[model samples]
Target: MKKLLLSLVLLISFLGNSQILDPVKWKTKVVQKSDTEFELVMDATIDDEWHMYSQFTPDGGALPSVFEYKNTKGNYTLVGKTKESPYKKVFNDIFEVDEYYFAKTAQFKQVIKVTNPKLKEVKVYVEYQACKEQCIQQDKTFTFKLPEIKATEKGEEVIKEEPKEEIVPTEIASNDIDSTSIKTEKVTETKATTETNKTEVSNEPVEEEKKGLWSIFVLAFLGGFAALLTPCVFPMIPMTVSFFTKQSKTKAIGIRNAIIYGFSIIVIYLLLGILVSLIFGADALNALSTNVWFNIIFFVLLIVFAASFLGAFEIMLPNKWANKVDSQADRGGLLGIFFMALALAIVSFSCTGPIVGTLLVQAAAGGSQIGPIVGMFGFSLAIALPFALFAAFPGWMNSLPKSGGWLNTVKVSLGFLELALAFKFLSNADLVLQAHWLEREVFLAIWIVIFGAWAVYLFGKITLPHDSPLSHISVGRLFLALLVSIFTVYLIPGLWGAPLKLISGFPPPMTYSESPNGVGYKNQGIVGATATLPEHAHFSEHGIVAFHDYDKGLAYAKEVGKPVLLDFTGYACVNCRKMEQNVWSKPEILPLLKDEFVLISLYVDAKEELPKEEQYVSPETGKEIVTVGNKWSDFQITRYKNNAQPYYIILDDNGKDLTEQVGYTPDVEEYQAWLDKGLKAFKK
Candidate 1:
């Protein structure tokens, strides 16, 4: 099952490698004014569907065109700032900013006066980002030479330089630079790097994001089906269908009304998703996954929901709201059918509300703004289908099992699962804060109790609220008891430091444990010979020694004559943990991770505070950087342009990339091939 999910993740990543978009073409013309003066003219012709932002575009998300003239102070003097053609001002919905951009054609001019007599050429580069359905970063380099001035015996006579033009093959930017500005003075020169060789829209990240939404949809759909079997909804299916059949003039009208009712139910849930998206917004969604406070709140919220599900007390909407919606259902028309759907939602809040709330939280944590909407659509569809189908074919109504003790049994079982899931959020917070409150063994112990007790309950050993008195376990109940027992047994070894691949993403990582090795034994993955530990290093699970500090890891790799494998991971990153448990622990890959590379695991979400002297303000975002995680996160965005976790990069002795960096690779063969490629490059 773990392998299957990883394969799904990889498949989505490959599909996400969409064609790269290059919507703007750049051409540079150097107009020679005299021996010392030149006007660098740059023209951009944009594609019909796309637009390029000007340098003055405000900070939001869009990239603006920027020009950098290298080594300028002693060599040349700027006559004025770079001038750009008038552009269109438009509002961008996604970033919510007033973007200044140009369509069709645009021109920019920079006038420079040469000061150095011996200087022959000056290099200039311009990088501009253009967007249509998606955005792409592109850049081009140009050089201007000093015009000739020949001296006669008595006086100086000038033979002027001719105007020269340089066309496209302009390099594009892969890394991020906050805001837009034309530099008169040189800051730091970066390597001209491209993210991919593909010359179309490289929106593979977008598709990978969709993969997460797809998973949420599937989970939510399953949740909806579970909601249908609960006490609040299952009986309503029969009674609601019966009302439609008896009240309508004909069977056709009855079926139509029922369909409308289901659609209205769908709309109601969709609106709830929309409301969630609006409240959180896109930027906040990114932080929801790893934020300590949010995780703690979610932990508390799920605990309350679990307690409600366990028959301690009921969770319900206000009685007045349901009463009002129920009254509207009696109006007898399309409006009445819609109100009937609204009433169902209000009435079934106790059972379905927790499930809906959980789904939304999970979806929002995916960092995709549209995730909740997609999840709610799937959830509502699963619920809505039954009402419409049953009304259309009234004869099928006899097939459903009679609502009884089994419904409450389902609810109680969910309560147990919820109790276990609640700890996962707490664990997320613990991992991020590195609080050491919930380590590996303690987490497994909690699950052991939760699942073990649930198994006992299934076998008729205990009773809870709404449970009918039982003499013996039913066949189905007995089967579920056996499965839960097997799973509970499976968790026992986890206390002694098992990977627990089956529940990889739920628990704390193997690194955050009472013992990095097993409970009493050291891992055998290390020390074919005795290996001395490096500074800032610790033994992770599988006895693979790793460094938490980047400089230490890289320095150790240099001393050991090995390549550096930079793992930009996160403590609360679900997929990051999944890769560690399932992919990194594999027999074929474990040796490579252990032996070939000096592994540096930089936790981007680590919440440890940096020292006061080390802390400084970021020039780009102007935010005060106070923590180690925030510093590394900035390093990643500034150096790589990508910001997703479980990001991997292989480097030689120096810090340059050996190959293109990759995000969240799960396939063993594919990942091994990438490792091999890096090894081969390092050898060269």
Candidate 2:
């Protein structure tokens, strides 16, 4: 029986690991405008089971369907950008089920406008990731040329179309362009030329990009390990092992039971994964990340969790209800063991609930179909393992520390972390509302108070319902508490004037603050208690200020005759914080930001929305625009077709693209290279 069970488990594991992406056939085409301009289109014949994301998804969700046009001379304008065919599919949520999809044979097209008509041929490069039951992605490029238009007569003038003609470029027919003008047009006299240069495109079938499956596996493993430390699972290690050891009456039998416990954990976690994948689907993960309502929901949930951690309340399953389930674990079979595990899980809800909630939230927010499953599995494995290991080497259990005051200390530390994390969500809302002045100093002020109170409590200056008095202070504990208290005091200087650079990115942008000194602050850290705007603000309370929105930023730059600097940033991103401290603080970078370019720091993680009258819901994703940050974040994702934060896009007046670099590049030289690239792109 044992051998049979082991073989079955092994087979299931093999099947899970063997999952792969389905085959997809792809094709490309070029619609030329003249010798210098053209539109490039890529089409994918997705298998019946698979579908790709559309261009306008909710920010923070899936990667926006992107078109990377390479080998062009002047510039590749996406001609109002790429659009996917529409479709409909069913969605099953915990509360309700709905259906959604874009059309079949999704066509992604981009129009590339060029300068220096002498420059020949352009290569359109495209990269995308598609997933079904399993996920596989590919990076492919399409290269084509603008076929030169043959002139019917010499020295004819070309007339530019109405500005409105460029809007919705895809809907415009090829015949709409002046066929008579192409023949007579001369290069120098060309006011604006529209040439429909259609190049026959062969659809190339391609495979998905092969990811380092091992890396994903390892990350999943670490996630499981972290889950075990949560209050819910840790206590079970000893109890489960003891139960098996007592029943087995032999070391070998005990070891086998422990192994079964671990296997049970894996099975439970995998089942949860299957359910999530089935319900959310792979593509919807993207929407969850950027959807304003979803963000709001996440914020509320985290607040509840944080409050519970802080001893404001305890969240748990009903006692009579949980006890009924626990009663079933003593039947003495495989089912009984499973029930036993469930009982253990239910009992530890108070301690483990917050951690599990946090992990699950993070995993879901990642927008990977497999994320929740992998995350749960990691958590369960951590919770499951000590039982088996202790059974195998029972003597090792003696070395473990007893649960006492230290356990309460651990809980308090975690509470601190939870309270700290809650501010980030709040900050997200604050930034979107244009509630500036909540800079890093404000964040520090609150933290110092929280920690100071905590230190006092540890020293028996205060006590909570769950805490005990310290009879005698250990030297080590005294030293640690003293150090923390001193650190708390250290933050006070920041209230008046201090460069708290260590956590610059964690707060709102520095421009929001009214710090007496001229030293600029990143829009991070502290938030003001009362809602108010700067006296010179041009924005309505909800609308973006002058030089805040993209169009406005470009206009301001044009008015000032300064080059435009577009900052794609987020409220929750940790790397952005590091960049502000390490690079932005560098004397060289600081001066450049203050004087060289017109800075437009767009916050991609802001959660406040416009009033109901002004708020717009996205037709593509069925999510509302609730906050100021949400508007800009959505604009960046849907318009620019990029989601990664800490992205920098440089543009000129008339909304011309200059340079765009995403994510953090640590090397100073690499950053400098981007700086130079943007300066040159603007010049062009």
Q: TM-score of each candidate?
A: 0.57, 0.49
Best by TM-score: 1
lDDT of predicted model 1:
0.73
Off by over 4 Å in 1: 1-180, 183-202, 523-684
lDDT of 2 by residue, 1-684 (tens): 954764464345334433223334555445445544455545556667565555543222223455665654354444554544433322212101121323235655566666645544566545444444322233344444444444323333323232454322222122111111112245343323221111111122211101312334455565455435544555566766577777887787767776776688677767876687678765565456445555567678877887776677888988986777677877877787777767766787787777667666666655556767776676677667776688667778788766556555556656766666566555544544445534445666677787787678656677555665678766756776897788777766666546555544344443344553323332332144123333322321112232456666676677767676677665434345556656765656655554566667776555566788878965533445667875775676466544445656667766676654434555665565566666776776
Tens-digit lDDT string for candidate 1 (485-579) = 99999999988877777777677656677875578655353553235667678776466788888888888888888998888876534456567
Worst 10 residues of 2 by lDDT: 172-181
Q: After superposition, how far is residue 684 of candidate 2 from its true place, in Å?
A: 26
For each of the candidates, the C-alpha root-mean-square deviation to the true structure, in angstroms, is 15.4, 19.8
Worst 10 residues of 1 by lDDT: 190-199
Question: Which candidate tops lDDT?
Answer: 1
Q: Kindly provide the TM-score of model 1 when superposed on the true structure, using C-alpha atoms.
A: 0.57
